[model samples]
Target: AQSVTQLDSQVPVFEEAPVELRCNYSSSVSVYLFWYVQYPNQGLQLLLKYLSGSTLVESINGFEAEFNKSQTSFHLRKPSVHISDTAEYFCAVSDQSNYGGSQGNLIFGKGTKLSVKP
Candidate 1:
């Protein structure tokens, strides 16, 4: 079975602080990694993804993560954060074999709560 695991359930931080959310996965076959963010009362938005070619992937809003095949991990990091970044983050995985001509079924972790204070 392909599954994703998020190490942190909640992370609290002051405004303009740095943060990281850890993620790991176990799968028998190839997989794709993704980080998604969801603000209160909103849908999840794609933060970043590790599809291929690069071990390190970054989001447009200053977050980055590295895919480690050996360890089956992909951890998210941001040098500095804002109160606006307060949201819930989820790590997801989709097995390549399941990608049947479209976005495959996404298996999400329990989720990580990121609280940025002011």
Candidate 2:
């Protein structure tokens, strides 16, 4: 069994401030970790992912997350955030198991609502 836990339900930051969204997971086997962002009234978008290879993965939008297997944590961070960066962020995990012959479902955290202020 695998599960993700977001330590914070909400984070408030001023514009151009550094921010970090914490995430931790527990699983018996190896897993893939991801961060997704959902803008107001829109669908979720992939922010970054850690599948294999390098433990440090980055997104084009100045966000980075490092996969720490020993800690079972994949924390998302950005040096400076903009007002537009405010959104609901979700942390998800998926194992290699394909349930019912379908793609394995992603277990997601409750999400952290990032509120960027002016």
lDDT of each: 0.92, 0.94
| Candidate 2 local lDDT, 1-118, one digit each (tens) | 8999999999999999999999999999778899999999999999999888999999999999999998999999999999999999999999855553215889999999999999
Off by over 4 Å in 2: 99-102
Root-mean-square deviation per candidate: 1.3, 2.0
TM-score, one value per model:
0.94, 0.94
Cα TM-score of candidate 2:
0.94
- What lDDT is obtained when candidate 1 is compared to the true structure? 0.92
lDDT of 2 at 62: 97
Residue 115 lDDT (model 2): 100
Q: TM-score of predicted model 1? A: 0.94
For model 1, residues 1-118, the per-residue Cα lDDT tens digits are 7999999999999888889899999999889899999999999999998888989999889999999999999999999999889999999998777745218889999999999988
